[model samples]
Target: MNRLNEQFEKYLLDNLPKSKSFHPHFEKALQQMLVAGGKRFRPLLVLSVTDALQPLLLRNALPVAYAIELLHTYSLIHDDLPVFDNADLRRGMPTLHKTYDEVTAILVGDALNTHAFFLLADAPLPADTKVEIVKELAREGGIEGMIIGQAIDCWFEKKKLALDELKFLHIHKTAKLIAASLKIGAIICNEKEIAKKLYDFGIDLGLLFQIQDDLIDALQDDTKAGKTTSNDENKNSFVNLLGIDGAMKSADELVEKLETGLEAFDTKLKNNLKKILNNYLYRHKNL
Candidate 1:
């Protein structure tokens, strides 16, 4: 991993003060989920943008960055639950529901979801800034974003969809949060125009990302995936709509678009972010 990646990983694992001592159950689940290793890409994005804007971000960025992680982890927990994707494993370990129980998993996810905003609310940033971040997170992670996307995905199972429809579903379901992550981080830095650009970048980047994920799911072994593979067999995907060759072609085109989009930004920041994206693409067969 590169220096920025390593630092971001370390930041993700860094400890924080426990909020009082009233709730052990929720805290345990949150801590355990937080410790489980993953890319920590979203938080890295937030932190990196903050770094670009300011020399030091650990104090103001940590809580909000952590809020993003908690929300993400909560999404995974629910996504892995029996009712949704019925996934048993995540990040190469038993999912929250599988590790604990269905009810515990549900509560854990809920706790993370609610607590994420609480963290945001408690962030040391200015009140207006915190409000913007909170609103952005809620909008992206809530009904207008992931939830709706998930609904469309579930609704479209075993159903064929037009390319535009599929794109819309992916945009809402996955891309929005990514876009929001970039935008919110920029907002934290009080860079509105940059935030907007980051959000737009996120949209295209997210499309590329979800397409890669679909591709990986199509090709990878279940054990390697740590979750279901070919499970979206019934859902709309680039690999499902376009064949493997076509999917790869589309993904390459999207990557090109994403790169082109970054041309307007600071060369160094764009390069570093692209490096991270490249690492992801190279590590997975789908991209």
Candidate 2:
């Protein structure tokens, strides 16, 4: 896992947009956000799917993986803006808006968002395949998906959200992009059935992740989590909607469901995915 993360980081640096000398500050902001240490979970999903189906295609899948990371980074930048979450920290450092100006932060996010598509457009895949990949990403990351989820979250802040409503919010906001990562990788290999299965798996995995995040926020302080904690105090989170005990119960159920979903996969793939799920469980044992 460490080696895979190292390789992905190198590839990301190599493919990152070059900074113009005249616009050094603008480029610096973008670079800083990208370099801010993250788990690179989304890209790993893309690579893992490809590795399971066709390791030979991993080289060709690099661009797609990078594009997903770029898109995820853009969303983080925007999510931290003053008008949004007004977050001060991300990836254990000052957020883009806090490090730079609001305008710069916004443009950096815009650049990264559009540049993600640029990477996809320039990938070695066939035109039809590229189109499918682009359509999936755009729909998942756009209004029909993440945007709507964010809108609902902000629109209903400070209000109690029912369990189903909270699930709907997260399914679009967090799970869609995650599901896209897996689906895009399967699409790269032309495995439609596998893509759908991975999508289903990703949805459960994403929800589990979000629930764990809420638990962390409620239990840990900012120093422990490496970012602003308690930020969800006013937001509709699983920890808020469901009591901590209830959220923990939900997470256990999700883990069982996710494990069962992998039964149809080959042993190697199932083991690889189970490793990831177990890592998540280990990290949030308090839950």
Candidate 3:
């Protein structure tokens, strides 16, 4: 995974979006969140799955991985906008809006969002495979997925949603994209038998990720979390809906479920998935 992260980072640097604009910082802002760094969770999922099933295709899969990162980073930029989370920090650095300006931040997010698909369109993969990758990305990260969840989240601030409703929000906002990452990798590798199963696992894994993030937001300060903390006080978060204790229990249950599910996968795929998830699978429990 370390090797993969290094390779992906190199790819990101090599393929950064280029522009020469009158504005001084447009291009820089567009690449800021991505280069500043985060967990790289979604892209790693794509790479890990690809590596496990078809090692020879790992290099070709980098573009798909990068596209997911671009899309994910765009979401973070928009999520930090004044009208949204209004967060000043992300990935351990000042958010684009804070470092530059709100307008710059907004436009950067839009550019990154559009460029995600552009990367897919320009990848070296075959036409049909690229189309399938595009479909998964669009379905999971588009209006039916993250956008609607973001809409619900912004609209329902300070209002308590039902437990199921909260799950729906996070599933759409977080899980769908993560699931799409895995499924897209399977599509890239022609592993149809395993794609749906990996996607299902990704949904639960993404929920677990959100739950853990909520726990971190509750317990860790900005310096520790590398982002704004205690920011979900008014939003529907796992730690808010379920107190810290209840949220911990929920995480525990998910950890057990995911571990059990891991056992069902073929040994090689299971090992590969486990390598990527070793410390992360139960991160909240340590808190």
Candidate 2: the clashing residue pairs are none
User: Which residues of candidate 1, in runs, are more than 4 Å off?
Assistant: 2-11, 14-27, 281-287
Model 3 CA lDDT for position 68: 96
**Model 3 per-residue lDDT tens digits across residues 70-181:** 9999999999888999897899999999999999998998998899999999988999999999999998998988989899998999999999999999999999999999
Go through the candidates in order and give the clash count of each. Answer: 0, 0, 0
Q: How does model 1 score by TM-score?
A: 0.91
**Better by lDDT, candidate 2 or 1:** 2
What TM-score quantifies how close candidate 2 is to the native fold? 0.96
Query: What is the overall TM-score of model 3 with all chains considered together?
Result: 0.98
* Model 2 stretches with alpha carbons more than 4 Å out: none
What TM-score, computed on C-alpha atoms, does each candidate reach?
0.91, 0.96, 0.98
lDDT of 1 at 76: 86
Candidate order, lDDT descending: 3, 2, 1
**Candidate number of the best lDDT:** 3
Q: What range of 10 consecutive residues in model 3 has the weakest lDDT sum?
A: 16-25
RMSD of model 3 against the true structure? 1.0
